[model samples]
Target: SQQGEEDPQALSIQEGENATMNCSYKTSINNLQWYRQNSGRGLVHLILIRSNEREKHSGRLRVTLDTSKKSSSLLITASRAADTASYFCAVLYMEYGNKLVFGAGTILRVKS
Candidate 1:
């Protein structure tokens, strides 16, 4: 079974607003990473937060990890219409493979 599960299966927001998504996992992970995928396009890696790290940020994106709760969150600041995409949270297990195990993902639609 997949280790990570994302919440708020779908979301809709206006441009300039912030979009937040959460992920919960069942086991201890080496790291948690977030990715974004535009409709019909490939997935783009966003930010990654290690189990030892509490938070991380890249550009307009922020990621937080709470190992105690086995959860993580992604925040997109000042979202734009172009931000409309699907976001996924992946769990990395060293004992497994180097590839990431992703969740079902959340669909976000940003309106202008």
Candidate 2:
């Protein structure tokens, strides 16, 4: 079984907007991390919030975790064309062999 799943496999928006993505998972985890990937670029670590933490913010990015619901959310404020690319969330845990199983991903396109 897959550890995580993300919706809206793709997203597009005008520059200077906000983009939101949701993730759902099927197991317990120590924490969840969000990562961004630009076209032909490697995955860049964004932010990670522990299971005990409800939310975390980094720059224009906001992340939320709901352990009980086994879900999480990421909200990017004032998005830009630079944000265009694919976004993904990974669940981390030793229970899963300490591997980062990523969701399919959400592709965001910001129109300039």
Candidate 3:
């Protein structure tokens, strides 16, 4: 399966600090999207940057893509305890949006 694999399976950070996570994938992709899970209801879309793009940011979240290396990085600054959740990066192939696949995910624990 040419999918993404998130690192630090779990992380602990203090509120008002920052959290960084890494994801590596196999095979080329059309785009990559990051999702956040809270209360296990489902995943909420965070960001989606294409292969031709380099970096993208939304509020406190920042994402970088390296197509050649088949990897990506996510940075969240000024993290809050409410931000505690699992983060997963999904590789978007030609049928990405149609049939999205998910990574193992990294659990973020922000302590207040």
Q: What is the TM-score of each candidate against the true structure?
A: 0.94, 0.94, 0.92
Summarize candidate 3's per-residue lDDT along 42-95 as a digit string, tens digits: 999999999999999999999999988889999999999999999999887775
Ranked by lDDT, top first: 1, 2, 3
Q: For residues 24-98, could you state the per-residue lDDT of candidate 1 as single tens digits? A: 987778899999999999999888899899999899998999999999999999999999999999999766766
Clashes of each: 0, 0, 0
lDDT of 2: 0.90
Using TM-score as the yardstick, the better of models 2 and 3 is 2
Candidates 1 and 3, the one with greater TM-score: 1
lDDT of 2 by residue, 35-100 (tens): 999989899999998989999999999999999999999999998888988999999865878788
Best by TM-score: 2
At residue 68, give the lDDT of candidate 2: 93
Error of 2 at 34 (Å): 0.6
Show the lowest summed lDDT stretch of 10 residues, model 3: 92-101
In candidate 2, list every pair of residues with a backbone clash: none
By TM-score rank, best first, the candidates go 2, 1, 3
Could you give me the TM-score of model 1 versus the true structure?
Answer: 0.94
